[model samples]
Target: MLKAIIMLILGLSVLAAGFITLKRELSIEAFSISSADEAKSEMKNIFNDQRWFYLSGIALFMQFVFQGFHLTFEYFFYAFLISSGIQSLFYLFNKKELDYKVCGVIIVSFLVIYL
Candidate 1:
């Protein structure tokens, strides 16, 4: 029972962080391009940008490290939550999209909570 409560708190905290990251990402200025070609060009430019790659790499690396370890459900739950929070921090600081990262965090959180 105590473990369950702790898991709930950790999960909620991570989810909240993910939401904040999403909010920050959405709050950024939307790009405006008159033509599809121009938009594609701009998007490509953004996609190839080093900052995005670095952020994504860090997030992925953290996920790998968290998942690779053999941990109890409670530990995994707490570690994932903390990792998600860190990822959210990365997004918040770097202005990167949260998207699937948030989803991954939520799914793992629930799995750990119920398991």
Candidate 2:
């Protein structure tokens, strides 16, 4: 019972985060649209901001929903691992460091496969 409740809360929280991030992105999009030519000039920065965070939040929500509510600690751990891996991969890729990207991708891929 406790486990299910916790899972529900976490799932909702992740879901909320996804929505919030999406809202922020929409607001930014609106800004860009209203700013005329200036927005297009800085298109790169606007689009890239916080996109990964929103994606990972959605991934986290999916992890719980797909795994189903359970009492086992492994589910919780795996959910976190997958969510974290997604976020980390986003970070590494964004950093544009080849060595870190290679290692991070390998680790994330292995964890994702386990899912």
Candidate 3:
């Protein structure tokens, strides 16, 4: 019972985080678009922003949901792992700096898998 509650909370939190991040990155302007041109511009900006955070948040939330339901969740974890790995590589390749947060995600993911 406790585990299920925790899992539900975690899932909701992740989903909320994704929405909050998207809100922060785009601001209210994202919701105030008045034309197709403005919408397209916002879409482009969103795509170029820290999109991986929200994407991975969704994946993690799904994993938690699956676990709560006593269903398979490994696929969601793998999805998160692959996306996080790619995002971290992009950080390294583009900025010539390792994204420690993403690296941490990768490490946690591996630990989750093995342990």
Candidate 4:
């Protein structure tokens, strides 16, 4: 049915975004390793590694669960918005640069779905 197809597409798109965000975060962490090593001269703690990725992944997974429960495009869209907001908050907390373009994409995608 149309609803199922839309949900599938939305889920896949969100998952793809999450994966890309994770990849970017990992790359940044790798870049920061040298600086961190110079500061501490010790092995990095895994708990402190790639925190944004973990947080974003959790938020995205929660969105996925919410979407799956509703089976409606609107719910999926809202979930995406909420997930993006959560990710933005994580970025803010980490004092890292935020991507307004990515946030715009999420918001625009949700508006499109709502329409």
Estimate every model's Cα lDDT from 0 to 1. 0.56, 0.50, 0.54, 0.50
Where's the lowest-lDDT run of ten residues in candidate 2? 104-113
Instruction: Write down the RMSD of candidate 3 (Cα, Å).
Output: 8.8
Considering TM-score, which of the candidate structures 2 and 4 is the better prediction for this target? Answer: 2
TM-score of each: 0.34, 0.32, 0.40, 0.31
**What is the lDDT for 90 in model 3?**
48
Query: Sort by TM-score, best first: what order?
Result: 3, 1, 2, 4
Best by lDDT: 1
Each candidate: RMSD: 8.9, 9.8, 8.8, 9.2
Considering every candidate listed, which one attains the maximal TM-score? 3
Residue 36 lDDT, candidate 2, scale 0-100: 55
Clashing pairs in 1: none
Q: Could you tally the backbone clashes for each prediction? A: 0, 0, 0, 0
Instruction: Give the residue spans of candidate 4 off by over 4 A.
Output: 30-115
lDDT of 3 by residue, 1-115 (tens): 5434433444554566566657767875534769999889888985875657654764565455544644356656554654555444444344433355456445444444344
Q: Which runs in model 2 stand beyond 4 Å of their true positions?
A: 30-78, 81-115
Candidate 3 TM-score, true structure as reference: 0.40
Q: Residue 21 of candidate 4: its Cα lDDT?
A: 71
